[model samples]
Target: MEVLVSEVVGRGTVLAGRYRVLSPVVSDLAGASAWQATDQILDRPVRVRILEHGAVAPALDAARRAALVTDARLVRVLDVGTHEGYGYVVSEQLVGQSLARLVAQGPLTADQARAVVGEAASALEIARRRGVHHLALRPSVLHVSPDGRVLLGGLALDAALLGDSGGDARSTTRADAVGLVRLLYAALTGLWPADPRAPQTPGGETLPPAPIVNGSPVAPADLVPGVPNDLDTLCVVTLGPNEDGPHSPGELVRELEPWGEIRASVAETATLGEPMTAQFPPTGAAAPGGGIPVPADHDDQDTAPVTVQRQSVRTAFAQQDPPGANRPGTPPPATPTRATGLGPVPSDAETPPTGLPLITPPAYTQAAPPPPVVRRPVAQATAPPPPPEEETLEAFGFNDVIGAETAAPTTRRFDPTALILILVAVAVIIGVVLAFRALFASFDTGASSDTDPDPAPSASAPAVADPAPEPTAAETPVAPAGGPPVIASTTSIDPSDADGEHQEDVAKAYDGDPATFWYTQTYKRDDFAGFKDAVGYAITLTQKTTVSTVTLRTNSTGGNVEVRATDAANPTAGPVLASGAFGPETVLTLEPATETQSLVLWITQLPPAPEGGFRVEVTEIALS
Candidate 1:
């Protein structure tokens, strides 16, 4: 049953009992269609994915489940169920347009691209924290909303299906990062890596060349013009072939420091210290009674201590004194008489001029004893030998006090043993110095010997001895006259061939300008176990003109199918183009703008129907 865009719009009902269809968003060749819908339970807008009737249900289910566990950046799934023999999935509705669409509109400015990179890095960080790896990341899968929010969606779980689950999860993330680097490179340079001998489609068909212009590779600065050399280096380093590029999103975010702002408030807080109310501050309204005051000036006088006696005297004077009782209208107490050391009675005569007190002397008595001494006969004691006269060091030509000699200077006579030891030390030092000199000399000699004396002669010897033979005009191969025009192709499958093998599956040529032709293919295969039983086909195009652009399109006969573009000569050249779910039909346009001799098309894993094999067909090819 071929489903027309009109028919899908006509069938207005709840899909899978969860999503109520609103309008068709897009459809691709894998028979997968996206529709705007409202979730019954959540009451939120969601996108519904409806697989073709004969597509593999289990594989789709597996993918949905893996997405739920793997990536936080993916749109959340609300429900999954079958309706009218077709599988449908309810997912969160994104409010954004694909990055591809943005690029098509216009290349992003440097600042705009940087902002997008930050958002993408943040999203990837979230995924990394959750241990989810997005195996599929392309411009088409990356979306930017009207409000400038970036979202990443569409995860591929083919490896998970094959059970090669070891460190592949990490590898998958790195691979996706590399792919993003390539995409960024392409965006910057408008060229891709060269592939001249790529493989063709599984059938005898060939695909056009990639859309890359010229044979030039992209430079980081070209994509985001005016980027600093350091930033460019960082991008290259992060996207380099190192196994430890960045294991987590946080690490990746660190490389984007150029975009982060320096928070002034945070810096001020750090400098001023923590809030005063937090466990510590001043304890008084102004200065505490006994507490030290903060100095207003840098002088020590402000905080210096005064003598205690002076302080006490000042305090005593400050106290109030009692009134005197001796004279009328006068204070009773003045200065204390005891303190003045004056008598209590008043003197009748004039007081002495001095303010000192008069004192009386007391009489004293003493007893003395006297003793008589007899003359002693003193034998003349011989005076000890005159003590040796002190000889001052100064007398000996030295200062005595400053340089006193504690002992006599004894002449040190060198013994035979000491003399031999001295000689041995001198010999050892001489030997060591000579040995080091010889060692260094040898090292220098060896280094010089290793280097060729005439480097130029040695380098040019082979080239000069055996020069390349000059080519004769007759022996040189000349290109065909009027050289082939570049070929371009764009394909979008039709609903009629939704479940049948595409006509373009077989090798074919077109009568167009051979410069601008679009090619399409469709296929249907029943009995697929969601993983196996894939539909395989090839497209071959003769070199009527040098092919430039090659577009591979796919639509599911029943369910959605994954599409990948690779070198037709070598299938492992790695997919140059890849995407998820070509619903009814999706177009992949390649325009290399260079001469391509031939091209091949390849398709695989067609959705299987219970009744019979699904069908697919290619619709158009444009060459110039």
Candidate 2:
């Protein structure tokens, strides 16, 4: 690939009708250049990389393959195309300082460095799970956000088109792990090892080659003193010439994860000191008392020292003389000494003055009970004479309205026994219904036997009856010979090359509607000339059953189909059971075998359709 003149492409140059180039970001040694661009249609920023003319189609395919994965840590390839003599790939314009730029300023702290590399490792793990290998990872291609976020750009497509690397997937992954360790080392020591394979900066500046002595890069311990022993050892071992380094990014991530946490804990522990309360002086200057102020009546009941509140007079006296001072005419104070119960006060002792006199406790004695009071009767007043009353009732009807409604009949109390009888009757009815159901189940089995002697007897052709095995609970009793089989689930391998949104047609075929169907895409030849083998439809029975026959109804039959029974959802591993050329309507009687859960209708060969192309349309399928 030859480099085009720089003047041919510059700022404001537009390519592929959608991406308008804003400015040139970088130019590779192979004449490939990446530019900042804008997507005119989507109204978003994009990065457009122009490659040699011959590499357009392959790069475009690679870009489309990379687009299948959606991860925020990687720059997304939006579109790829060729215009004039150059191939251009439009990618999401990343907004952050490149790792190269970040390192140019200064080295990162161990925590920051680990965070960047760990995040990158997680992204690599995701891509690896998705079957994507980033073979072009380098510090220059990596972007760092203000908040330690690492984004890996420069996808493998770029490397593929530029012929930068020839390593396979395994080698690529190992190289990525090595790249991460190198990035970490650079972040720690601000010295990047020189490697021709490492991606170059936009200005095409390479990192200073690491000073190597005795077949190994000089250790970070010799350059930076306080680098942790674990970190230094990890860097040395990972970058060592021996094949003992981590082989994958996950291995590196696991080894690094604990170091960051352990370092953080050590730093935190070193910063911790005595509690603020403990730092305070034990005298009154700390608080109103020697320690935290407590309510007067508060008590912990423990032997720990307590802070007693001094009264105003005591405080004043304490300031004058903390211990009781002896006055000139007070016969001096009693000597300040510990006293025992048998000892007398010393002549020169100093004793604390008491605020109030102590009173002796009262002697224990039983108190006398109070006497009961006697009530005196007062003079009684004379009562008035009783009033006269009439007890006769008045009625408007005959016989005095039935004797005044029979004394307003007494209210009746509820009887719970009637409710209990009703409940008993309901229980008896339910028991009878269950018993009848049990009796009718036998009749159902007899009816099924009478109708379906063989589970899958063909209509157009007679099928040989298979040995009737003992029925199991999982066997769904076949309905009659002509009835549809009970289906629990339906699945199909709908090749994407079909008319309209045909994947939904898979459900329509199993819906038992004669009007709807699932049709194969028109092919140039009968055997799905351009498609892979094993393109088919599958139906799972409601239970594991020995299918006797399968009947297919279709408007057009342009393929020889195979009917297979297997316990696996995917029947690709084994040979199909039965196969024959199908007409407009076809019936296949299966040989009696062990119960199978799934039945597949696969296309083995194709014939020309009536409409002049090779296709098959199946409207309905019945299995019994």
Candidate 3:
């Protein structure tokens, strides 16, 4: 009979007799459905995979069983059993988005992309050590949890059973690395790789490749403009060769250490069950037997009761069997023993029943009483041993251990008096050195002062000795402009070879074409001390052909400033349409002129100079 919603399986409708099924997480092609279940035993939430009746059921069961034996970083199978002809495997529920989602959003910042891949590398390293390989590390299979925990899904146990895949570990690791590299490339460049011969998915639809340039995977720098070279190198190295790269997850962790503090806060917040408002279809939310109402929000407090009940059930199972539990009346599986030596295998006469004596061969064999094998209780067996003494220093190499000991003296036996004396001596030495440095500095300062040039008089300074009689000239005033015209003024300057010549101090020089200087002063800065009084400066330009437009703008207060320009050029003399004060940064458009040369701009009026003399620098100009 098909199970219906709210139907209790085991103690409750949860896996391992702990979880309470709230709703379906996802339903797969097989009748198996993934559900969002609360752990009644642990008071936590988990995902339960309910298998449907199919040919793959037995195979999946075996895979799930095998999964329990390894140390792989693959998803942990919490419980597995057959209920009403339908098998289910309950595993940990990961709260995160798929790598595919992150890729689809857009290219990640260099740091973000590195972190994502670095995490995957760690998971892969763990799998490698445990002799398990995740054959599927595609964007779809890798999940970046909301808490930034990277979870790998879709193990290859079943695949191994189906084929003579001798290269399970190697192939999986290689493919995973390759796929991670591809994902990183996409994240950094917003482009896919260019592999023309690469086979497409079974349907003939091509998968996205790494970002490409000229038929080769493009460097991260080529894809994203202004990506740091170091970051680019990291991406390349990460994707280069797995064997030669980070040896293990620990090494990968070290490699990623240089990235500024990871934003683990996001992960922490996620772990605390912060509500996510953005609506996306729930993952792993399908019921196997019948209609079940999955909790819409995993973070909801109301779900705690269900989780508590699930935890109770889990606790009961734990007390019953525990992991590796061997119950009374159940014979432990026989362990295989191999005997190695010279002569033909001895018969029952030479070989002791248990085979312990055959390997050593006692001088005078007396039938030893059957050695009683003492088995620890399952609960005690599962408990970990006490941590070794000096645990902190163990992970570091011996050299590091010794170095740390020598460098950091133990304070327990230290003499305060002696330490104080030593500190005093050091302080005396430091003081002497500082005193000498101060003396020399003072001397140098005096010397510099003696050699310093006389300061120029301020513009408001009184004339010394009646500054030579003012020269008489015809008084010319255009409309008798007063107080700077109450000048709500804006200056628009176009970049050109002529402007380059007249403004050599401000224009950036280029080696390719001396006349074609790149616009370097696109950002506005308040540090332009000379242009304090100026209101604003707008640059206008037009490019005739496709060319990279370079601009450098600056303003006062070193506030927001942007350079804006069009890819095409204009023919008119007044291409500049408007100019405004930069409350924040302001982007002004410059249309290239049809005159073959990209227009150069100089805006001198916005920031008025003191004494009518202002200095605004526009260094470096280029069109390509």
Q: Which structure among the candidates has the greatest TM-score?
A: 2
What is each predicted model's overall lDDT from 0 to 1?
0.41, 0.58, 0.43
lDDT of 3: 0.43
- Off-target runs (Cα >4 Å) in candidate 2 are 1-8, 53-58, 161-166, 195-203, 258-624
Report the C-alpha lDDT of model 1 over 1-624, residue by residue, as the tens digit: 254533543346776566678766653323456677777777877776676543445536545554443233455555666776666666667655555544443344333444455456555555544455554444555665443445565443322322324255666566555545444443332233222322211211111122432443334564434444544565455554455455554455444422311111111121111111111111112135622222132233213322111111112222313333242223333232221233243444234335445322121112233333322211342433222332343345432233212222324566799889999999779666665654454333222223445334442233332233443454366986435444343232221222222333333323333332332222122323222233333233344444444443333344433333333344323343433333334544444343334443433444443344454433333333
Error of 2 at 450 (Å): 59
Candidates sorted by TM-score, best first:
2, 3, 1
lDDT of 2 by residue, 9-100 (tens): 67778786677777666544355777777789989777777875545666666676666555667777777677776677777776555566
**RMSD in Å for all candidates:** 41.1, 35.5, 27.5
lDDT per residue, candidate 3, 156-236, as tens digits?
Answer: 533332332326555556555555566556656545553253332221112355644444565777545545565577556
In candidate 1, where is summed lDDT lowest over 10 consecutive residues? 271-280
How many pairs of residues collide in each model? 86, 10, 78
| Least accurate 10 contiguous residues by lDDT in model 2 | 274-283
Residue pairs clashing in model 2 are 194-209, 333-349, 334-348, 334-349, 334-350, 335-348, 335-349, 335-350, 336-350, 526-606
